[model samples]
Target: MTVAPHPALSANLATPTQAPAQRDDAPIELSTLRLPTPPVPPDTCVIDVAQLFLDANYAGLLSLPIVAADGAPVGMISRYELMRVFLQPYGRELFGRRPISVLMNHAPLVLSVETSIGDAARAIAQHIRSPITDDFVLVENGRYVGTALVLDVLRAVEGRLADRSTELERAYVRLKSSQAQLVQSEKMASLGQMVAGLVHEINTPLGYVRNNVEMTRGVLADASQLIVAQQAALDALLGGDVVADAQARLDEVETLRLRVDPAALDDTAALLDDTLHGVGQIGDLVINLKDFSRLDQAGAQKADLNHLVASALKIANHILRKRGIEVVHQPGELPPVECAPAQINQVLLNLLTNAAQAIEHERGRIVVATRAVEGRAMVLIQDNGKGIAAENQARIFDPFFTTKPVGEGTGMGLAISRQIIEQHGGAIRMTSSVGQGTRFVVVLPLRAVVREAA
Candidate 1:
């Protein structure tokens, strides 16, 4: 039996709208891969369908959609099916005049034009079989729109994946850049606070040194007057001047000598010693500032953790003193730990600062102790302050997590400290009881280890 060809099928042979440019933020739809191949009516003969496949116009297509009278897709007829039929002995004569539906796939993979490329690929995966016979059909509102090749859908999906991978790589790069910036900003903020304290630390010594110099200047002036008077008396005596004149010069010398207290000389010497000590104190502070400001330097070295702790403590002394916090340093003999000194200094300072801030009352005490345990360097910082809450302890190291009031903290100190420690092949842990106190322990390997940037 034969069937009349549908006129609507011929009208759809015109090219469809071109696909839009792909975007990373947008999901690609199946319509972008659609090919407007004309469909065949269900009653069309096998011979006529075979002739259509042979035409160069439809050579690239694997199958043609078989639509019902109302434009609904019923099945698909593939080139492989026709080739099989014609290749068989006496096959063309037996089935050539029959309806193509007799050999068409009654159930094809049908998807809407609005389906995402990923979803379309998944559907094809589930429904596809070995030896890949037919192309999937694209429809709109339950009616046939056009047919698309399985190979085209596969290519589109692959392209989308490649695009997604590229986008992810870019995003990762941006995230790393942002992280670096944040680390540097925190360093600057810490430095600013440290500088304010250091200024006071330096001024205390500078004030005494200035006063000592002034006192010494007064002593030197009196001594010079005595020297001049004694010289004059010697000149009068040696030049055979009158006894009265010589006696007058000698009397002037005696008077000046009496005015210069003998103890003033001794006191001047002591003042000089104190001045030297004050200068040395200033020098040591400058050195600590230099070490603390080495934030831009990268690379690790074997360093005495005790020295780093001391330096951090010195810088933070002003803060602790202002709050009347007592700091106890108990450093034990241990092997040197290889690490980035500047970064470790930053971590120590951050911890000390946090400890100082945690205390809301006078009589705050912070104990910093170091020891070697099992070939690893350990630093324990315990603070007697209002400690972290039980629920908030777990997320203390999470980025941007803070219990402090807004504008008083950046919430990155603990997070960055943890990152720095972990990158150095170390671990940091915390234990606290709400009103009792909090203790942070940092354990580090005593040998150098390759570290990756976070």
Candidate 2:
């Protein structure tokens, strides 16, 4: 007949062990969490261990682990216990002759290197040994490796949880934003598709009309030369014609000449030239719009920063012109930066638009410059407009934080620009004085470094 086990022991035996709950996102493990091995005296060593404690004090160790032969952890000894033993009268004389293992916990908790932080934490919580303040010994395949404090494990796990939570929240926000953008894009695509066809229809005819206008201009030039020659001949033949038919023909020709006004012809040519220039500008604007809006053009390659800046400047030329903002471009010698060109162009254009908008004066000044120093490329955009107030400068790059009136700003320009620059291993900085001017500096690495969201 088997004797019945004690009630508590029976309960413990009946309870099926459940694995510790672990989040899928937890990044901490025993191997990474364990502190470096602390001072471990051989289990056979005498309790001159008090001296070991003194030595440990100098070395800044909190505790010591007693290891047996073959480097297997036998037990751990804490500084407090050792100090208590030595503080007693003649305690060293009585105990110093014995092996340090006498004072160490023979049944110390052990953890394997592959244990998850969650499992280790569970083990720590369930431990019922006396002097629970002792650090846990970390081992790999029964060989002593290191020690872990309960505090370190808890802190690491907590930090990991916080980071994972933050990441999920950010991802959720991005997902919602992306969904909205996709819906808006679909509508825009439908509109653009139909408009593109109309544009093609109009452009095809407009192109030929321009060609014909050019040809007409050439023909008119030739006609002007012929008319001049005819007038010279008419002057020579005046009052000298003998045949009545020839005289009448010459008179008719003279009448036609009188009807051709030189000034009017000049005006017509000027109008054609102006029309052609306007058509060209429209074509360019369409191209820039496509470049700005195309979401599928995210290919990275070696690109000239100055060329990207110029393209952006060209796109924003009209805004500058309207305000009479004078742009001073100093394209410094720079190396090619590996980046997605169109995205960088958009960032530059956004900065330029902000620069143009900041100015309240007719003689606004914008200085755009590029330079390479210390293996990094830099772009500087400075504007002398009603500058950004000092108080508002910090939040200028925050999304939806704008100084402009309600409909005039969505406040995402600088925010998006900074994001794009940072994605390419770069940074955007700003300096401004309320009445003087504002300057934006974009710094980018020549070589891109891959980064994960913090």
Candidate lDDT values, in order = 0.90, 0.71
Candidate 2: misplaced stretches above 4 Å?
2-248, 263-280, 294-296, 449-454
Candidate 2 global Cα RMSD: 13.3
lDDT (tens digit, per residue) of candidate 2 on 48-119:
555665663324445666665465777877777777877899977777777777777778788986788878
The CA lDDT at 388 in model 1 is 95
In every candidate, how many clashes are there?
0, 0
Q: Which residue ranges in model 1 land beyond 4 Å of their true spot? A: 1-5, 21-24, 87-89, 448-450
Minimum summed lDDT over a 10-residue window in model 1 is located at: 1-10
Q: Model 2: which residue pairs collide?
A: none
**What CA RMSD would candidate 1 show?**
2.4
Winner by lDDT: 1
RMSD (Cα, Å) for all candidates, in order, is 2.4, 13.3
Give candidate 2's TM-score.
0.52
- The candidate scoring highest on TM-score is 1
Name the lDDT of candidate 2.
0.71
